[model samples]
Target: MINLKISEPNPRESVREYAYRILSENILDLVLVPGAAISEKEISDVLSISRTPVREAFIRLSQEGLLEILPQRGTYVSKIDTEQIAEFKFLRITLEQAVMKLACSDFPQKLQEQLCNCLEKQSICVKKRNHEQFFIFDNMMHDIIFTGCEKSYIWKIIQEANLNYARARVLDLSSRQDEIEVLFAQHKEIVKAIITKDTSLGENIIVRHINKVISDVDDLQKQYPEFFK
Candidate 1:
């Protein structure tokens, strides 16, 4: 098993919240990694927080599907459940496409500018070959697009679902230069489609983008079946 290292806590963070964010990010980034065993005391000591907060965080993460609490075996970073990932992908694509369609009809100038900035950052990340930052910007781009649709509740659900699938998508980032380039091109097209109020074009591009991620998951599962549940 990999030895997970937790960071020192910030003075401003509540112990339970800090533990939650740290553990959640680690899981999404695959740093704690899937199927890894976890000890509350070990995490508490490493983060310099008490076991109580760590336990609270564990329970929260378990509720979020990021942790598995086995009775005698103890808590573990949850395995990658392909079925869940598929469900997440389906929901994200379906809801996000609907949002894009709505945004196409009622394109707002402010939202477009925000999405433009995100796309700019995405370009910079690509130029620098910074995968982590690229992913962050990619998320911002989607956030701007989806949140602009005024469907806040659905947008929030998409965020949680995307987090569940993000690690697998990130793993597929290595040496995916051509695919990455196509993504930026598609982003531009999507933006243009929205700007021109072309709902069909926007829907098509977003659907293709999401399907590509699903395809990548298939590639990953084939390459490393052990990493998945």
Candidate 2:
């Protein structure tokens, strides 16, 4: 048996939680690609941690719908289920639309400044073609808006779904440069709608933006068939 012990404790959690965070991020970012075989031994070697913590992490991700553990076989990243994606789309659109509406009515100036700052960073990343930076900024931008909504439970769900989607999107965006300009333009529109308190326009913009993701899923499946299979 692999010995899974930590000499010290993490400020936020036990060793198991730390392990879960690292492994979950890797899986969600496609660092561990879907359908790519993984073993507890490999995880132990790579993380320099024991199988217990790794197993704990795997269980957490499996609960989050990002990994699968076979009874007798090795663990694997979960396949991209189109039906689940569709459900995600429906829930995200409806909830985010409502959230945007709330933000239009209640967002403070400080929040607007933060969002604009995130947008500026996005523009800089685009000009430099720094995808890693752009990806982080992309997340920050939505996060700011989601925070402005002030719906903690809904935000939690959206955050989870976004994490799952990010792995696939990072791959898709790496090849789809044309999408960059279009996405930025929509971001501007969303910001403008929020600033002007145009709830309808903001909601419409988000709906369209999410639709593009739905459109791109087919391409993602084609490019990374094994991941999706």
Candidate 1 RMSD to the real structure: 2.2
RMSD of each: 2.2, 3.9
Residue clash pairs of candidate 2: none
Model 2 stretches astray by more than 4 angstroms? 1-13, 162-164
Would you list the C-alpha lDDT of every candidate in the order shown?
Answer: 0.81, 0.77
Name the weakest run of 10 consecutive residues (lDDT summed) in model 1. Answer: 1-10
Model 2, 1-229: lDDT tens digits are 3222323445877667877876776666566777766777877786677899988888888887888899898788887676677777888889878888887777878989998999999899889877767878877777788777767666666777765466667676677877777778888998999999998898899899877777798888887777774
Taking all chains together, each candidate's TM-score versus the true structure is 0.90, 0.88
